[model samples]
Target: MRSTFSAVFTIFVTLSVCAASPFTKRAVTLPPLNGKFDYQIGGPYTPAADVAVVTRDNSASPVSGKYNICYINAFQTQPDAASFWQSSANAGLLLHKSDGSLFEDADWPGEYFLDTRTDSNRQAIATILNGWIDTCHSKGFDAIEPDNLDTFSRSTNLLTAADNLALAKLFTDHAHSLGLAVAQKNTGGELGASGKSTAGFDFAVAEECQQFEECDSYTDVYGNNMLEIEYTDNGISAWNAACKARGSAISVIYRDRDVVPSSSKAYHYQEC
Candidate 1:
């Protein structure tokens, strides 16, 4: 009886190890390094044949047969969704000033920062963001670009860098679990190298990095996996400078500030 019981226990342990192996080995697919890229977050349109990657809003469908990235305003409330965050269901998720007025991003008037100061608030925000990640996965997106990670800079001390990084880990971990890679969007200058690993980001989506002269800040971490967008308003000089420096190593594109579609008169797109 003792021998039989010991044998049964050993078999159970072996089976359990086998059952857990897949989860331990599971990995998310990262985007192709230095691929031709397009940023269509303003609205989705078919990409040119040579384009290897495209980023679209979460509400937009992924472009077929390309490495598609879904954009999520993970750190703040969208201007149009202000009412939803203000609603009772999402109370305490938005940061408030000492006077109890809602704190808003000065550059983006209607958009407000999501409170990330406490574990409870971060978990609450994650519940809502994870649902969006689920949709991005369902829509066949290869990665996630959680924008406004630097919202802490605009938080006027109400939120700290640590606060936002904590929430970023939540976003990245959930994305990875669904086999989708995550981008550390436009916060390299602030978060630096350690923050990249802490947040579990696979790559980066850096806007106006050339204008800010911060391309190296991202490249030091993401290498060729960085997708750079230089605004036309910043002039071709910034774009030229970026291309001259890292064009061969990373994906670099010049786009209009609005990122309008080709059909629009304001549309502008160029690559190096």
Candidate 2:
């Protein structure tokens, strides 16, 4: 149930782009821990304050010479991109309920779940995602923030945690093969559960970890190599608590839930 960017879900990017094959290269350097950072997945702007890292949606280009994290909605369908999925070669990959209706994210009206129930569907989806990863590299991004890792939690009984992690490994391996660092999008509490090193994730992009008391879970694995976003508009109460209690190594920031551009009247962004 992502509140940000739900209303403007019409934006879509083509998934057909050239990409290098996966699992043939080594992982790249991660985003600097404890560095200034910004999350601009909604829109991009000049760095707010010498931000060492910035995350932007796939529709946007990477910031030059910055540790850019390309936002890839890997687990579920973005509200705006429903048409793209419907028309995609892997259209069958969309999950559906027993009644044959679309299985939505419940929290987000237009967002739908991607079916990772089988290895075949996973590979097909990976083909499209790999193309996106290629775009990140071709556009000069240093890393990728694959969103919707928690989609399985909303898939009713159609998907499992194992299903999601399997898909995640595919993404991480593909990104690493392209020499791009990969990030765990949320505190799924599955990192160590899989018996993989950091779940093969180079870092994390946690949203309101302090509010949920999941900060230690991430730092326990990725350490300071993570950035967290807290939103006042979202009724987040831990902003102050996080600021007061967080270690210097954890980069934290506050933004309007919408994450509007700095120039927008709805914009709200801050750092701690």
Candidate 3:
């Protein structure tokens, strides 16, 4: 009886260790340094032949034969998915206002912030985002570009940088366990600077870092692993300057604000 009990306990311990091994260590792959890439979160289309990397929305299919980055709106609810979030099972994950109303992102009306103020809320949010990361892995994505890491700034004092970083660490840790690298999107000077190392972010996807003259903020941390996109509406000078300055060391592209497909009339794309 004593021998049997000891054997059973040993088996349980071994099983537990095996189950947790993946989360403890995995070989995560980072994006190619200075690789030409496309930002297609608006919609996915055929990337140019020279493009080595492509980013697409979570709902979109990965581009074949290219390093694909799956875009997940980790910080807030998508405008169209409001109903799903409003459902009882997931509603508690959303941040609420003083009046008990949903907190909406002013820049993006209809989009609501995810509550990361508490550990329970952050864990719940991480569970859903981790599922999305799982789907990205199953779809053959090389990495994840979690949008709105800077949502705390737009959170109207309800969410702090610490809250967002805590949630982001959950994301990066989960993504790495699945061997998927995570990108730090925007928030160049603040969270991008302070949280990049702590959160385990492998690289950065900056929108208009050049236009805002904060490209160095990302490059300083992510080095040549930075992927920069400058909008045409912001003027060509920013794009031109970025290309001339660190173009050889990093990936830089000019895209339209809408990021429409190449077939569209307003479509625009340039790379350096």
TM-score of each model, paired residue for residue: 0.90, 0.90, 0.90
Give lDDT per model, in order.
0.79, 0.76, 0.79
Q: How close is candidate 1 to the true structure, as a TM-score?
A: 0.90
Q: Which residue pairs of candidate 2 clash?
A: 9-80
lDDT of 2 by residue, 153-204 (tens): 6666788878778877877788888799888888446544351363477777
Mind giving the per-residue lDDT tens digits that candidate 3 earns over 1-272? 00000000000011111211236537877778888988887766788898989988877789888899988888987766777789898899999999999999776777789999998888877777777887888889989988787777877788898888888888788888888889988887876567676777888888888777788888888888889888888899989999999889888988888787778798889988
Question: Which window of 10 residues has the lowest lDDT sum in candidate 3?
Answer: 1-10
Poorly placed runs, candidate 3 (over 4 Å):
1-22
Task: Compute the lDDT for candidate 1.
Answer: 0.79
Give the Cα error of residue 172 in candidate 2, in Å.
1.2
Clashes of 3: 0
Local accuracy of candidate 1 as per-residue lDDT tens digits, 82-175: 6678888786899999999889877667778899999889877876787787788888999998888888887788889998898888767777
Model 3 residue 231 lDDT score:
89
